[model samples]
Target chain A: MKIIKFTFALLLCATISSCSSDDDTENLTGKLGNIIIKFDNGVDDQDFIFGTSYNTSSGESYKLETLKYLISNIRIKDNNGDTFMYPSEKNVFIIDEADGNNAGEIWVTLNDIAAANYTEITFGIGIDQDRYALGADGQGDFLAKAEEEGMMWSWATGFRFTRLDGTYSSDTVTDEALNIHMGSVGTAVDNYREVTLSLPNMAIVREDKTPELHVKADIAKLFDGTTSVSFDEGYSQVHVDETTTGVIANNAMDMFMVHHVHND
Target chain B: MKKIFLLASALMFWLGCAKSEIQENYVPIPLEVEQPSNFPDIVYNLDNNLVTEAGFELGKRLFYDGKLSANGAIPCAFCHEQAFAFTHHGHTVSHGVNGGIGTRNAQPLQNLAYQSEFMWDGAASHLDFQPIIPLTSELEMGETLTNVIDKLSLDIYYQEQFKKAFEDGEINSENMLKALSQFMLMLVSSNSKYDKYVREEDNVMLTQIELDGFETFQNKCASCHATDLFTDQSYRNNGLSINPKLNDEGRYSIFENPNDKYKFKVPSLRNVEKSFPYMHDGRFATLEAVLNFYDSGLVNNGNVDPTLLRNDNTYGITLNEYEKESIIAFLKTLTDNEFLTDERFSEY
Candidate 1:
């Protein structure tokens, strides 16, 4: 009778352990979730708006009619230093200012992300050479998307990494064309840049949960960060010029900051 | 219990096989693009959008279809006629939808797979994206990409073609552009008399005059118009007097670089005989006029190509009457009748 009782106890313990093990596996493996990255554009302390005038440190006031840029190659590093790269096929995005909500926030929702505590987010400001070399087939819908947004150069086969089309007023000129359409000039010059922002706190993601990350992009830093370029010195119309574009690209790198994260 | 487990396993295996069979429908038939013996390596990366028979046919159909244009009457074939080696036959600058007159002359569509860039200003960097310029230009097709895709999506023919052409085939701009690229990449013009003679095919040999012309071309014009492709593919200011009315700034307008002012891509003289009037603006009416311009009509444009500068500080090639005639003979040898009359590329 004692032998039978011992057998029963062993069987029950094994059953309980197996059940808990299965539950642990379900929680740890193949649990995919979603993440929303909110891009908030601002000119210094002021929120960016269409046709709204903003002053720059270089003694120039500017108002934008069109503002958009390309973002690509998104990746996130977990707390354990394991990096989770978004699928290359669908990683690229265009952040058009016109597509902002009433609160002036543009959201990019990334789905099928691995459930983990992400510490840092990294992304490219423009199309990279590897993506460009893939030609039209690799672009999928991005080519048409970029073209429709006017973030692509109609004349050249390249993405306009950053497009700030409007007018600028200085001591001499008032509301002259301030087209800052900067991009890589084919395979010769590469204006693409990568920016990595460390999250203020760990962003906890779970299978049933969707986390939101708010990133602030200071537009004024594009002109005055690292290298200070004045509008009067022919910096108003920025296109494929290596010096001017490099300056803008470098400055754009310092523009983004992870303001906060919501683990909801 | 054993019987029940066996039945469940069999059911699972059957379900897995059924899922795989459904996915097999999208398996693509890979098509290879031919590389001519005498030509340089193709610049187009074909690995991304491998050429398929269905895709090429769909592309050919799109090329001839006028539904891509806003007016629904102008097609790519309107300006690019196959008989004239895919150039606007007589127009200095071709007209498009709603009678919109374009500024630059229409370039021939030949050997595009080998070219890294497109347009006289090298505007487009890829063959697949080249159509966007003409398709959206107000002076060309005058249509937006979204409208074109929407129009194409409505057609039952395109819907079926898209399914046959691509695995993930939705009648979207991506597949549409890929189909167009597959067609353009196959338009190789390498069967010219010159090519045949060089490749030692068909017992072809150039006559004495043509041979002499080739020698003169080698010594005089080979620097810019180099290789079997007939162009080094460099942009240069070839000393043409600027047409102030048009004020076309050439490649300088691309980046606004002062050094690039008045520079235009050196055109391939593949079908130069049929593709006229020649030059970027189509200024020269005949081959003789073009030769004459190179001989004496060169202007002292500030950014003129340094290679064109003679010891006497002149910008003209010292070509006599006989040299001109022979060069023209050699240039005519580049006319590939096989390419011009290929039924595959023909509209009718």
Candidate 2:
């Protein structure tokens, strides 16, 4: 009887210990930081329009009823030069406002943000080539949401890598469409743009906490040297015009240099 | 101790009996279907709905029942006739419950598993989400989802089917959509003459005229209508003149881009003979009309595919009378009668 009781007691203790260990593991939640994205529509900001269209020499004048895109594959640099990239599983950031204008601010919660003074942050404007090439499943939050949000065009052929739209004037018409749609599917022209963010040096103090990352988007820079062209008179649309394709490709490439990469 | 042991045994046996009772109430469905050898496996299978004879029968009954429709005269089977490749015949646009017309042509559903996006504009990207648009569209069903659920909830027959198809016999939007998806996804089409020719599974032969037509199709139309599956999965301005009445911009409606003006997804030509009145607006009544539009009727403008536009403002691909006939003959090879008459998919 004593032997049976001893064995039962051992089994009970084993189960209890196992349960407690699970509880201890479950209690360990990771630290995270809030990311705020602010769109600076402020380079001569008088009702700034950032859109894609077919009315401009660039292609067409397009207005954004909705302009939410994915930014993922994030890497952060500390003051000591130690860099850490967020796990590929869930790294997506979106800044979108319908009605053809930037709403100025967006926010996302960053996970597993260890306590550190991060000096610089870098992330892709869209999904990277590797992730894009990895085909459907490698695409996580950003790609999935962009798809769900109707941003990603039917797989391959081409994706609207960047969409900028507003009214412009050609020689003949005033208030003509100035649209730039830059996308590349298949070949090297794949339109996923990589954008790095440099945060304005600010300290976020927490007991085992990381600072909040603030990224800025300048809507004015999209059409810095671009103008609108009229489709009614020019007899041109997206695929037919060299000017439209050139401007779109150049503007998307221009995004890399315009963004400042930093973390505070 | 003996009494307690006996009690525990009785408890175990009673639990087993209770589980068996649950089984007696719930019917399991068979999940057998043709999984294509070359193509990838189907991502979603109706394991929950189960493929039991009873479950499919119930689903078919629900599909054909006009009680789910707001007007009670229109059923799911009304617009989607089994005879016409699951698409309405001769109706340019599908008429809804109260004589309302839908924006785009009602696409004939077949080999839907291979489709990456749904709708002519590629709005609803998933099969699961596609039904929501039809069910909620004021023109189509004219009935709210809640009304359908409530109406189905009251039925004893549906209740039994739901019990067998889902856990605990619970009926909700998710399960309702899922059940519909199960029924619709099973509407697979792979036994066409074209499919057999490609598979080399049949001793079928094409005449020299049909061969010439096939060559013409390969040169002129194959870029959009690719082989085997028959769609390049891209939206293009197929030189269709916009209907002033519809004012449908196709992809432009979704993206709000003037560049995407008049661009529509290339429809698969798997069973094109049955899915007549081609194009987004269903303007053309016959395949000949569609070919004629491509042959010499493409309207000239910006965003039109360069291949379709001629230097003289006319569309490209001017086929002679014999060539037109041969092309039509080649197109007829795509018909899959077995798909339309499959006993597994048939309501009866």
**Reference-based TM-score of each model:** 0.53, 0.51
Sequence-dependent TM-score of model 1: 0.53
> CA lDDT, every prediction?
0.86, 0.63
Candidate 2: fraction of native contacts reproduced: 0.00
lDDT of 1 by residue, B144-216 (tens): 9999999999997887778888988788888888999998888889999999999999999999899989999
Q: Model 1 over residues A59-88: C-alpha lDDT tens digits?
A: 887778888888999999999899999999
Flag clash pairs in model 1: none
Once superposed on the true structure, which residue ranges of model 2 sit more than 4 Å away at CA? A1-264, B1-24, B37-55, B310-314
